[model samples]
Target: MSDVTPDQLPALPVTFRPGRTRTVLLAAGTALFLVITLIALLLEHLSPGERISFVFTAALLAGVLFLLARPKVVADEAGVTVVNIVSRRRLEWAEILQVHLRPGDPWVFLDLSDGTSMPALGIQPGIAKRQAIADARTLRALAEERSTAGPGAARG
Candidate 1:
């Protein structure tokens, strides 16, 4: 068990979260739920099974949309952490070899020194191209700074 409280957590200097993307997704989900519910209500003779199915479908859709809207990436002097729709990853700055956000790519990817890449879905091109690029650059800068500072400097 850890002794530190939430308030004692190290502050992340940079955090990227779904901006317009989250808003749009939430709005769309709400609109979809309303439309479906209205339609189902209008059908006065809906069978019990049909009603249950529609409710289940709406709930599932909402859950998926919520997950999709919650992606985020946080970076500090120590490292970067990415939380996506279905996964999360934490990487020390020394482990990140590069940050890639090329044209045509959907999101930023961190090339790790271990020869693997991790996608940073929070910095998605679809959110805002310029903002996404800026976030990627900021993450890259953090990685570079920490890498040059030598191992464990951030921890100290």
Candidate 2:
């Protein structure tokens, strides 16, 4: 492994991560996790079952918060995958009609050829405006290049 050069490594998918502000969620989740752990430990009077419940609830809350901070969009030669807090979606190049990142929008929206639109929360604006826009453009370019159907088919 030490002899391997960078070029020998497999191409990595381009991943767009959430802005810095999202770190607050991670910190807050950690704090909550710690606090709950402490509380559970300190509550010596509680039954074993109650203690277990407390710890479980704390873990669940922390997990949700941490997951919320993990929204991301990954793109590769094949297609794009969007991972949000509660759900994930995969779209092939031909399925995407356009990539929209207009002002006033919270995040990039993928307008699909199916006449439905899905928000790519991974490439959000606000804190990371320029990066988000660039990522959107990259997605659009990929869609245009990879789709077998001409762009005109989806423009309408």
Candidate 3:
């Protein structure tokens, strides 16, 4: 066991912002699933078993996909966590090489030491520009601070 005091660690920055694309997709998918299920239920020509199976399968698949498509971003003084619609990746502040705010880019990206880039789920294309920029700035600042502080200064 290691003796580490919480105060010795820098506080984590609040970096999460809701993803508009995800919210819109989830809403549309849910609506479609419900409408299809209702139609399958009302149509009499379809076999009872087939109708039930189709509706259940469609609803289940849509729900799962929608859940998976939800994007999330988390940042602590120690690192940043990005979870995309299909994938998730994390980078410690020390590993972050750069944070850029590209005007037309769909999302914020973190350049890593290995020359690979990871998307920041906090800024979604469909969101308001001002809000996205604000969150981006906050994330960038936190990453910069941690980077200058050096590795092992803050561990999570």
Candidate 4:
């Protein structure tokens, strides 16, 4: 398939915008946290001895909400990029080994050549119809291209 020029294959469509569910949850959480923090601050004004504890708790909660709501995916010609909320690692296409479309899996995954795996940017099959199938096909084609480009092409 390496011989098949890039132009021959349909361009890889960018799948998955940042997780909307997570984004919404993050927004809600932030709003709640802010309200709570403001209440805590007002209480602190009345009770100075307890202010430090309330402030610390509010800061911690805000931090967690920020991490959870952070942008997770951005796709372009270079490849898909993923950012996990807590650990915040970014992965690129060159790191991917294979893409699988399994019945039970909620989203597509990039099986790394090193035996590790990362979830695809936003290719969730559970949500749509034609789009999901088309995305899966695109991913499979990309995987085939990578395999053919790898060392095993001669044996096959």
TM-score of each: 0.80, 0.77, 0.75, 0.58
Model 2: weakest 10-residue lDDT segment is 1-10
Model 2 Cα lDDT, one tens digit per residue, 57-141:
9999999988889789888877889998789988887787778888899988988878999988888876878777776776666
Question: By summed lDDT, which 10 consecutive residues of candidate 3 come out lowest?
Answer: 1-10
Task: Give the lDDT ranking, best first.
Answer: 2, 1, 3, 4
lDDT of 3 by residue, 1-156 (tens): 112232343356554656566677688788878888888988889999989887998788787768655777788756777877778777787887666668788878878878787787667555567777766666666665568654334423
Report the candidate with higher lDDT, 3 versus 4. 3
In model 2, how large is the Cα lDDT of residue 23?
86
Instruction: TM-score for candidate 3, please give it.
Output: 0.75
- 74-110, model 4: which lDDT tens digit per residue? 4455555665554544545565556665777766676
lDDT of 1 by residue, 1-156 (tens): 122233444356768876999999888888777777777767889987887778778878877888889899988767778899899888777788777888999998888778888888998989588888777766665665567554224421
User: TM-score for model 1?
Assistant: 0.80
Top-TM-score candidate index: 1
Better of 1 and 2 by TM-score: 1
Candidate 1's C-alpha lDDT?
0.76
lDDT of each: 0.76, 0.77, 0.70, 0.58
